[model samples]
Target: MEFKMKTEGFHIELPYGRLDISGNEENGFRPYQLLISSLAVCSGGILRTILTKMRLKVDDIRIIADAERNPKIANRIEKVSLHFKIKGSHLSDEKIAKALELTTKNCAMVQSMIDSIEVCKTYEIIDS
Candidate 1:
């Protein structure tokens, strides 16, 4: 994989895509997208690990991610929102909530992002 960043402009190019390295306030999808995705994957990974340890049977798991950007001169991502839908049976609400909490706490991506910015999360439990 190759990566390149412009010194003058706030743009960066990756092997697959280009990003605004300088936090382009005028453009879209700055470096923050990568950070946000990191959180999503991290949380998912953590939850998977915890559930496996607890032997909870999961039918399906999906995470929907979105972010709110601040369109100012050095535009930055201000807020990140996560919506999670979990499909599992024979699991208590408390156990699921605990797993979610632990996932947020342990996920390095979420943990790092939360320290510098605000991240919101909501979950839905589905019987399957």
Candidate 2:
């Protein structure tokens, strides 16, 4: 996990590959997107594990994040709304609610951003 940095135009040269980053949809992932992804996957993975422990059949887990950024102050993300779509069979609403609650309580990435960004979550359970 060590490499020389390419300082020309917000680029990084890693051993695996080179990353070209910017706010626009140009080449690589924007730094803010990475932050959002960390939170998304963190909750998704933990939720999956919890569902498995509860013996629920989970066909798929899709997580999407809607983030709002301020144009005035450094374009920092003011809020991140996470939407969770769980496709499964025989899933109960009570279990789903509890699972989401556990995800909200356990995700480290989301906790880390609590002081800076407002994190909101929602979920839906679908039959497989």
Best by TM-score: 2
| Cα lDDT of model 2 by residue, 27-73, tens digit | 45688988888888998898999999999999999988899999999
Q: Which residue pairs clash in candidate 1?
A: none
TM-score of 2: 0.84
Per-residue lDDT for 46-87 in model 1, tens only? 998998898999888898999887788456777888888889
Cα lDDT computed for each candidate against the true fold: 0.78, 0.84
User: What are the runs in model 2 whose C-alpha is more than 4 Å off?
Assistant: 1-3, 7-20
Best by lDDT: 2
Residue 45's lDDT in candidate 1: 84
Candidate 1: misplaced stretches above 4 Å?
5-30
Residue 52 C-alpha lDDT in model 2: 96
